[model samples]
Target: MRTTRSSTSRSACLPSLLLRGGLTAVGAAAVVGMAAAPALAAGSTTVGPAGDYFSASLSNSATLTVGSVTVTCSVSQSAPSQPLGTNSANQVPTANSNPAGPVTSTINAPTFTNCRTNMPLVNAQVTTSGTWGISAQHGSPSTVSFQIPQGGLEVQTSGLASCHAVTAPDGPASVAGDWTNGNPASTLVFAGDTVPVEVTGGFGCPTAATQGSFSATYQVRNVSTPSSPINITA
Candidate 1:
């Protein structure tokens, strides 16, 4: 059985994988182990700089099948309340703030089917963590992009024998959108391809095989004022 893995690129914002504090980048390397704790529940607000601080969640979901078993996967991320730093040129503070907190991704409700009697698939959950930032970009609407640098975050999963879930770990993963007046419910769609999960422990499939890939869309909203849109200032 032959499987392919996704490729990633370096991030300009975060050149170094490790930041000042202990927060790790997202697209680094996969650490085979049990899944980490579930990300903080959605709706939790993180107060930051003054421009546009909001909570964002990935809307698109993907399906990964192993042999006869299939599972639906989705991810969500929460920004931190503290400020990281300000861009000297633009004079605007970065999103989620300096010494940024860990932005976490949680897989919503995963289940499995079609497993052997003895090696039945147990609980399944995948979590990704990384620092986040907003960068200035040149375009029609004058937009800013959100980036989770390579090696800035870590991916892990729990439940399937030696199988562990891994997201984009080699390059930076980001999404951008045009400046919005103030629509908090606006959705920013992007692509997060190839979540290669390793299946070991003689669980019927070959060891270290690609479980499948996932594509996601994120919805950005202001938690403070649910009805109001988040204001983005470049």
Candidate 2:
């Protein structure tokens, strides 16, 4: 799936050698701004910079043994709070900032037919061909996979270098994958259903370096029961 994606890029180029405190400085600046922003109950995940000769691997029940992939994701529930501007004719009360006030949930039901066509990697990976030459930068491609099962629905997510808060990001996008295990003759059994995932933006990692380490959670939803929740305490 060679679909167009949106990602912010910079022209600053660093030497091939390890950056001495360069990344640390950049992260410190971004985190300062993030802390001043409001907070929410939801969380996110992000991966840091890896070496050029690195890997982007996505796995599951029946793994894809051929092509390579790496996916990134960030999940947050903090809504931006824009203060009342001075241009307003009347004075307004100071907006109350509440990180634990309430959360609004948006729900949807997608198909789960257990067919290959029904489920494919999210952040679709398109094969781009070019000469393996130096002087030009190479892009790290990845795939996001979510899983669904007959027992319940599971959302599995993954991300690459930019999945981190202090790097390039494509916001968030969601896709569903239909998963099935076993034969199709008579005793066909479904394992899980999942798809590509695009979550919210921001630093999902919480570390002592950044006040605390990042914590995140994964959930499962079903018709017969409430979603099974995983508390992502980073």
Top-scoring candidate (lDDT): 1
Candidate closest to the true structure, highest TM-score: 1
Model 2 stretches astray by more than 4 angstroms: 1-66, 69-168, 179-234
Off by over 4 Å in 1: 1-50, 59-71, 82-122, 136-146, 149-160, 168-182, 192-212, 224-228, 231-234
Compared with the true structure, what per-residue lDDT tens digits does model 1 show for residues 42-86?
A: 222222233433554544443333333333334344433444222
Per-model TM-score, in order, reads 0.44, 0.15
Minimal lDDT window, size 10, model 2: 11-20
For all candidates, what are the clash counts? 17, 26
- What tens digits encode model 2's per-residue C-alpha lDDT throughout 1-234? 111222222001100000101111110000101111121222332211110011111121111100112121221111112232322111111221223331111111111111111112222111101111100001121111211111111112123111211111121112212112111110111122112222222332111111111111222211111132111111
Error of 1 at 229 (Å): 2.0
